[model samples]
Target: MILVQYMTKSSITELTSNNKKNKVVIHLSSSTKLGHYRASCLILFAFSCVSSDCFGELMEDLTVLSPKAIAMANAVTADPPGIDSIHFNPAGLMQFEGDTLELKLATFDLKNRYSTGPQQVDPTVKASYENLTQSPYPQDPYANQQGATSEPVLLIPGGSTETVPFPIVPLGGAATRNAQHQMVFASAVYSPMMVGFSRPDDDLGRYQGNETAISRITYFSPSFGFQVGDSLALGLGINFSYQGLALRMENRAPQASAAILGGLLSGVSGQQIGPGPYDDVATLNIAAEDYLSVGFNLGLLWSPLPWFTLGLAYRSAAKSNLEGDFSMRYSHSMQELSTELRPIFPKMEGVEFERGEVKMEFTTPQHMSLGTSIMVTTKFKLNVDVQKSFYSEWDKFTFDFDQPLDYLVFASLLDSDGQDESLTLQRNYKNALSWSIAAGYQWDKSLLLRAGYQRRNSNIPGNALDLIIPISDADFYGVGFAYSTSEDSHIDLGLGYLVSRYNIDYGQSNNANSDAPLDLIYNPYAYLPIRASTRAFLLSVSYRKPF
Candidate 1:
């Protein structure tokens, strides 16, 4: 029988129990011991934020906040976009002379693709794998040739991983500039980082990440702006957010150690380790949330010439220690192996289903954006922006389990500093630079047309790429139209499409290939080249009026 304990410390509830085995977290503080704040229905509804887990792999410009911004491909650092300027360039808030309210809605149609080539491995390892799975009494014939799955999956907080339907996300904010017109104040709600995905229990991609992995990062900002000089504007914003992460994935030991064990088992007493080293031996499901994530934004705008405007914005970094529940189940094969090893290895502990509190630390890298807008003519303007992210702060993720883990015990053989109560995933991401250009045409007194293109660079090194978080350098194209509904009210409509692709050679990705001995949970297609493609379609609609 398995036991589990649920803890709620956010004043909504509280508890303590020893049920089974549980593990979690990169952050554990008084908050970890204090409790969880049962979120409202709204929080649950918004959990379906985006599928691009931004914790460390932040795609800073999903820029999903404003219709005008999206339509201009997020090249708004110099021109700003309604209340959403709190993120692009707070200084732009000064442009509003009185109280104004804006509403926005966005939708994403995301699709992913995967393909595999011939296996590329040392001849000896290949022989061992083929012998154990192909020439054996029981075999997985399709093991050598895996197919592709375009279906998308999502993590259901209180439930298991499941397929997701079309999702439309609602986002917007309100802001006002006092009568003095020298100062401006505004607030808005938005999503800066988020992503999630899932695969069938049998999908080959499951080997890299099975089930569903999710991340929720949202922001509510209150900002202030000052017209320092006729041509200079400054702004400051305090951003508070709710950050949560939930994940469910299968685990395996696909290194040479497991293949060797498989070969030995095939010739010996026949105690099944698995069909091969590539099979699943354990599964982990964890979920946690941090209601209070804090950060800030600073911005400046300068118009040195009537036709040229320059702007700069800086976004601060944040750290969150999420608290949540976790459950891990060890397979019967693993249990059997534990039982057999107990005689000689008296220190080994037999493991079963475990449930307990867990903690994980997450970080949002600091970043800066600079841009310029030039009015080529009274009716035409061009905007260009450059952005830099210090993703080097995201070196690794540390998951702290409430109890010792058997997998960690066995993992120690391959790793020199393995700890039974913790596991660290090394990302080794690099700093990235991205840029965009946009043009706007005032065709009529009440009609404006805008078009833009953006280049998004990849932060994941070539060796760290994987299907679960399959990101590559990408291109974003956008077009938008703004129409004046009345003198004080206007309507904006935008459409955007983004495309990215990756072609990883056999054993190129350290995260999913068998070329690395440290590859613990992945390597189902160790020797096979991989191809991945992603296409995202976005639509935004907005209406604004003075209040």
Candidate 2:
């Protein structure tokens, strides 16, 4: 009813009439067809839900801990320290004394949690009903028990059992033993040992059981800084980062659902399936890229009463365009299952696409931070900082796809709602916000300890309608130490951890035809409860020298 009402009121004819009568046309422009507009909207809507993917590959594995190393030790800044500051808080350069060069190497260890159950089972149910209506003995006890109905039925001979093994289906009559149900055969290889089924060659099958693995990401950062005035300094840092990812996934037994068994097909396969999810290997490569950006900082040294100083900084967002290669590959056994059935390979193109030298940019948000420190004694001092990111400026992203898929398949999956409906504009739906507070204390000049916390808002929407982006809100906690090696040299080290979580929600609409082959209109009416969490650990070490 809602779809019908919206279509009628906003129909092209209706829109044309409104345009002729009114001088100001509001909604969508008349120049573009509602279909294309809706398609673009759907694409953009999907992008907004996962804009985080737009950042360069390294960011997928990195997070900022404190704005600057000294500030990190003093717990005076919201963001993390290191060359990352050139991107997050350039104003941190203000504390530099004379001229200095710094170099750093860091690594990130990440733990991810993702899991999902069935989504939208209506189609399977409807297909079952259709099969029952075509049973051979429609009114027979067997047919009634299978169909749970006493209606007349029509039967048709299915595929050649040996030539194309159709699954032994309860629909249209008992499916021949050799019935070729490729979908079912594929499932058998996946969840080999679910309930009654057992896959003896589980290790060789594509759909192996549950699997887990870890990934290590590394970064190289170097910076040069010099003082301009009594209290101001400027610096430029070049950040180069790379990622090495290893993944293992367990496959579920393929889908051999039947109108007769209601998922009872497992009993017939008796294929010695393993006692768990199957296992498969995956490798993802992220190339190194250099980010060229600069930072500026200012400090005010004062002795109003001999014991206090104040600091202020405005960190501009590092304007950078990062370009790198992102590639992924996987090995599985599902393709082999087809050999036993049709002696042919099923062509699946989109599900396994990889990217190369994808150009992406990370435009850090403009930040404003204020800090104040007071000496309580000759050896003890405390510093505090508050900061905010103009995350709203983190706007839409542009991409140049090295490979484009078939238009029909892409359209069918992304823009199936027909026309006149969309959740977000394609290019402008992804923007986020961020903020943080920090404080640190110095017990003695030689032994300094630091700790800080931060929070970020998610740019993803609740509609859960994205294709390539992934967004999540995150929180961070950190601790660090600094040691004075000599008069002109110092070493600083920090450890930090961050937690991220978000949901992926979507829904299917009725009122669209059920019998039509392409009636599955995924409207994303609501955000489903999709919760994925990641625990990340950071280790950073840096050496600073005065020149």
Candidate 3:
């Protein structure tokens, strides 16, 4: 009824009331058609969802953890920061002597939006539905709408998963010279991704997902940097990380197959008897975490002359098996429909209240970068970096359920590539190449001015883009500065902004189709062209002190 009200834009008055059964019928104006279009493809997310495949790769660390890194657009490969060198280029640690400690704090403010584009439906698909249904409306059922979400959430596996204030991540590391070995040892803590967002239960965008957050925290990173030669250095780091994911989405299937079947049957039965394409059948909430995950990084730095230097680094790939719990709450209408269809599809056992343990297979691919830094003059320096992430390493993701979910079994029957206990979804992601350029100038003996820009490429192909993690090619612009408090101690502050926007044509994304003969997932806006965007503002502060 709410969907009807939103689409029809009519004031609904009481048509009839049955006090005995506590029932009320909505009266629609004569001009309003009872057409409620819902070609929605509701997806489950963790990178995928509880009962479907949807999420793709998430945002990387970028330069958020480093004030100078962000200020310099992550072009610091050739001129790594003090102790933060453990991440950018371990070899840079050799530049530090004696004891050094660094602390960093960063906050992120993000915005996401989705809006419907001009309607353009397939002639055959539209014609097929109109011909089969007895009470047919020629107009498109799914109308144009705009959606927004502001509430962000954080999930603690096996713990309280609550809504929190915007995230303020703290990252730091310490290192001391090992003169005897001519090597430097250090460790740090960081996260690859930790952001979440939510929408009101009745928000227009609830069909895609209600709340979602994916976290990859590196709790421990042990690193070593060795001075191999007078002008060369080598480094390696081993990282122990934790991965967690949380998602809550309202499920709906507005596929042609389901809608066609319902349309044909409704005509025969003289009424709408089962779930339609746009009906919100259920809500699924998933929380999973992996306590210990491992990966490694390597770095090389060379400086034959004080005027120029080159640096290279690689962060190894890793796999995680996040385990947790999931619950699916079915609507009363869906429950009754399942009961009526039980004779045929017995697995539709009315999953009004379903809970179980679940696990998923996820992979984080390796990353490689090459950078150079040059001192253009006594007071000016420039840094440039080229980076790549092997997202192509991702192909398929498997979701394992502790029990054979009856709902999954039924949902799988709609698609051939699905399984009862373990559901595998195809994910053909491509590698992304990005580059950055940054420059710094000494304003005076006590201050250094910095500015940088980076071009970030999208890993997901246009055909696979969806709202779960709708990251796209983006532009990152930043500015910051460093102030010398003492001869060897400095403070760094940076402010950065990034934006990624995409316009997905109708029927372009795989996540858009469920009725398509070959599809693995479903979304609510399948039939509508979608405009999605992400904008983020970052502020970072760092203090480096010699002990």
Candidate 4:
């Protein structure tokens, strides 16, 4: 049976005394659970504040450009259409004349699945606790043959090299194991004289449980444009954005199998580890208030020839002031535990505790894009865009501790060495620049075909450091079609597919008998090959009387 203990300590010293198995006391003073809570908050704060989006493989596949623009580009020449092309190549918008405007709406069905191999677990740490409990001792046991020393055979249940004791996930909560899927989109465009807007709602933590989260990355903007001359166009835009976040945490235990525990322990020999309250659940509710912010975009589109167009766009960065309410729901049994569980399943003695709220703000990065498109022939055209992410803008997250026992609490868990550090989490984000190239062919004035490729690198830390961002390389393939039904009526269709694969090396930070703590040794595990594919079909009819 998996057992979890929650306790409050007077100081880091109190934690060390009862830590028999020396489960790296999370933070240092409080139980590992609390330390994780603080750490997760700190990390999210770091990501939100830093221009971190640029570093991941996810950034390579999707851009701020709307789906309609991507679809149109894929359907014909990557020429700009609608104002959306301003972010890719504003020059496409220069093709519009008279009182012309285009309105398009789209949805992005985003799904993310994750899995890791047990080999990534630490064998020499508390994570290896299960090895001690396997049943059916090795036959002709090495122990019986005196003086003949050989490497001891360690058998764990179900072939798991080590079992995680308690919970010391350095990558936030187990909730990450839960799959996340959602849909969000924006549709807006303008002419040389008028503008309009429509933005779909964003769901944060939709995939990680119903946690409250302000989508720090959500964006909404409206824009206006004017023609400078036959070859040049200028546009200005205003951005209004909002962010809110809520993290829902449920009390959870390690994913230890009963068979593994049964075989590891000598005291509970031959006893079946039955399912019990160890699998119960409790909830932690975290709510961050919504914050409003503003920014702007400036763009220019140029077309020196009918076959070639170039564009540039810039967006400003803004900060959010966030505040929130935090509370936890406790299961009856969890509330009764007076001692904390260490790595070795040892119990800490005489601990007490209380819970409360956490608050902070996260920064979203600023970005710029330069794009170009060329109609190589009457039937074929190529388009390219290069963009830069301002990750340096994100730096640190700070918090205030006003509780009576805050000092003792912080010291024991987060800063055991008495560094007297403020509640600040540190991180560095690498600024990233990425590019995309696409090509399309026209079979007739009424028929078109397209195909494209894209690639991006990852931003995960080295094999030695453990961080939560699971960035990796990504590759893409896309095709689209457009059919003209009549001189004034038409239908359009497009599809895009993206694939991401990773051979990551992750370590379990929970090993025993070593300064390294328990670490899941490095091994390769393939998460779900992320797939971002889209299918879109559009129908429209229009008329223009001679003006």
Candidate 5:
């Protein structure tokens, strides 16, 4: 049998017995005499908040990947397209009458700033039993006397700023043969969506999330386009994708408080040790191995008149089952406490609390796009595109652990019934629509100039505002120029700017005071109000050649 025990101050023992076949056990000890149970509970509460909160956004497909497409805010659906049509509108591939090759490169300079209001002390410290009595001499003298107290609120002093640079390269090729009766075949390797960021350990939002690294989500698409007459064409493609991710964050435990506890443990073990200044923080790191998934895309191109063209495309959602390992590491202080307590707690000694396997289910949202192009004259053209992202499918994110993390003091206090724990974060995301419009002028056949504007709506609700991605509705403005280098070769260059901002205020209710510890932690940022904003600049270049 597996036995777990909780010793209360009244010399009462609460015993929880389980089958020995179970691999994990949890124990909680509270000394009522010294009023240490309250301290332990507070510590556990912080742990509960840290263990449950995880955040990220699905914003990859929203980014325009082609130089010319981005130059016009991705309004290329109805325009005569090149290799990039594999992603924007494969049916446009029919415009290519011969073998074609294209290479595109893009860079993003992104900046984010976040600020929070001043921190506030926990309200419990201000509570006093003396309020119940008016007597000059109270039963507890120290009850109402408050000179100095513990500051549980962790603050970054000021705010924080993060700057990151990202680079992307996309390659594509297409071929047409007369023997196939006006059919075009194309293949491309590109990233439809990719997002990542990292911050320092001392960042103000460290408790929320410090780093998110998604190396790549590469798509290998092979497509076919058929010309059914001169006015309309159809295309279909299969998209194979590979994805990888690594997420890391610091837990909310104050190292100073943990070190003090460790010193007390050392004294109980008949050792002369004091709390160390360096031993007070903990971090949890999770990394997912690369995984593969598949999806499909379809496109249609129709020109009803000599001066007007319409295009439609749909990209299916891809679901990925990410498997990885999670590891928890403590400061020197926690390691010492675990060492001393292991002897009295034999069950804890058998379990490896440092590492465990984790599984996460993620889905890339689907997209539907419609576009139209009008030729005002031979030298001037106008284009408009509308897109809808089905983000309602991403309602929540859950991470499942293969083994229990009993080493966390709060895990034992909050939920001790199971050896495997599942952590779920509610997203409640909603579907969003985005649109773009652009105009292009052909300055002779050798030069073309384009400009456009776009707006993307936020999928995250105000109640679910997150610190990791800090997503918000954004506006994009762009300009570009395409130059013909030779009879069969051309180069396109584009520049764009994106801007967004959000206000965040999660209330101040402490979880330690909750009726049920398992309930979600609320008002985690009650002490501080947040203002988050993002600014990014995009530069892109593409080279296309006919062979």
Candidate 6:
């Protein structure tokens, strides 16, 4: 006799048949099956939602271009700055005495670590699955009722830590022709906002994103500055900007579970079956062609006394309409699943493999700064600066696709309305503020020393936190020096370190797809607790030559 049992939320039943002497007993738990099935479905939901968009922290114009400024933690706003003043404080260009060229190179080494609490599960759901029973029937009628309950599970076998390195280069030249008026002309090229990160393919956070590389904001500025009087100067520049981006992410698809189920059923029926019907991996890659945009910068410098100076600078946001190619590919396992299931489930074939045009609009955000430099002694000076970034302007991102994806499988399992040709992710970033202070001592006519510190606040909220850009409030410390090789040439070297950490504790109950079927999937275990720590070192060098 063979007994087959199917348990539902309402009742449990067993079917007995008299066919052969040998007996086979199979038990199925409704809750356990549903949990595993929902887990697989969540993968599909996440993949479809992020396939067409690029994900990362918004770019801030916080790059340090001048080795001297960086050594001073960027408090050079009111100092007699160099050609890098094109970004720090254009009015400082007016102080240059002759034709001067400056070139700078910097390296960034960053280390990041992520940790999470145990996986949380719903407390109400009593049992998931119980040990298999070999007997035809349980000795006690209630024996079958004993089942395992859901509990916290660690997605990542172990917390992960990674370190990455990046290089930065900036070039600029400034010339002052009229000694009396101190009229200056300057031009420079530099990266204002650049970010890149990559994670292992098997990272548990792969669903959010695996790799993000963006050069999306580079600046080419040409400017003019003039001394208005012995006490003040003014400067202005037109910024020609360029933007580019590339993003990649991976997700588990519904076919993975479907294939496993098919394999299990085939085994029961005494039929030969392959490993599985679905592939467990799906990847999305998007690259945008470089685009051009424009913005402007204005600055003012005031000297009330020979030993003190005040400076103000403002840079407008860069805006652009970007177009690019969107491509997606599934693992071979997925193709195998499609072939194996086509006869039974034709609709599952040829899904999620497509290529088309993608478009989106983006903005870089504006920056403003105010600073002062005070000569404290014959050979010593103190510099301080406060800056503001209008990150609030970046509230959300929208991506439009030429063709919509067939998210039918997701719709059915997650009980969704269907798929759309466009998707939007909420950023809801807040404005950020930063301040720096530094002191420089002129040891002699040929040597100088500098030291400084800075503090910056994070702009992202917990709900928007992800692996691609795990940003947090940070503190920076720096030290540097300058050596003059001749009357017209000098070299500058600077080193800096930054440290930050943040914790996120929130419920995913209000996420984009957290309704209806999806709601059931998250229910009692939507809360996630995660912690991230970051450390970075910056090394920079610059050379200046005046003809």
lDDT of 3 by residue, 1-547 (tens): 1121212322224334344553334343222222112112213532345222222244575523678887888888899877777778888889878788888888876678877765555555554445444445233344577777776666554534567667677888888889988999888877666667787776666776788776677789899999987899998988898878777887764543344434333334324455554566777777788888898989999999989999999988887877888877777656665665454455557557888898887677888999999999999999999989888887777778877776665555444565667766667888999999999999999999999999988888888777777678888888999999999888999888888999888678776532343243565665678888888778889898887
Candidate 1 similarity to native, TM-score: 0.83
Off by over 4 Å in 3: 1-58, 137-142, 156-159, 263-269, 411-417, 513-520
lDDT of each: 0.64, 0.33, 0.69, 0.37, 0.57, 0.56
Model 6: residue 497 alpha-carbon error in angstroms = 1.1
Model 4, 147-218: lDDT tens per residue? 111111111212112212221111000000101221111223221100001111122111123321123332
Model 5 CA deviation exceeding 4 Å by range: 1-59, 62-64, 120-179, 254-281, 332-353, 407-421, 506-526
Best by TM-score: 3
Worst 10 residues of 6 by lDDT: 148-157
For residues 1-547, what per-residue lDDT tens digits would candidate 6 score against the true structure?
A: 2233445542223322233533434344342232233233333333323322222223243354467866887777787457777777788888677878787777665555665554333321222111121112112111112111111111110112122433444555555556765688888776665545565665545444566555533456778888886799998887776666665666442111233233333433223232221124456666664457787878999998989889999988777666777556656654554455444333445454756776677776788999999999989989999988787886776666676543333233223333445544455678878899999999999999999998866666555554445567778788999999998898998887777787655343232112122232211113234566666666778888886
Q: Higher-lDDT candidate among 1 and 6?
A: 1
Give the winner by TM-score: 1 or 4.
Answer: 1
Q: What is the lDDT of candidate 4?
A: 0.37
Best by lDDT: 3
RMSD of each: 11.2, 20.8, 8.7, 15.1, 9.3, 10.8
Q: lDDT score of model 6?
A: 0.56
Collision count for each candidate, in order: 22, 43, 13, 40, 3, 7
TM-scores of the candidates are: 0.83, 0.48, 0.86, 0.58, 0.73, 0.72
Model 6 per-residue lDDT at 530: 55
Query: Given candidate 3, what's the lDDT at residue 537?
Result: 79
> If both were scored by TM-score, which would come out higher, candidate 1 or candidate 3?
3
Candidate 3 achieves a global lDDT of 0.69
Worst 10 residues of 2 by lDDT: 184-193
> lDDT tens string, model 2, 1-547?
0111122221122221132332212122111122221122223223322232332211321333222332343234322243333433333443444345555544444444433323332444333333333322111111111101111111111200111112121100000111221110000000000010111222221111112111111133343333344444344444333222111222222111111221111222223111111122233333323323332332222334556655444544454454444444433322222122111111224233344444444454555655555666666555555544455564444433344322222233334332221122233324443444444555566656666566555544444322122236777667777666787576776777767765443242111111122222222111112334555566666666664
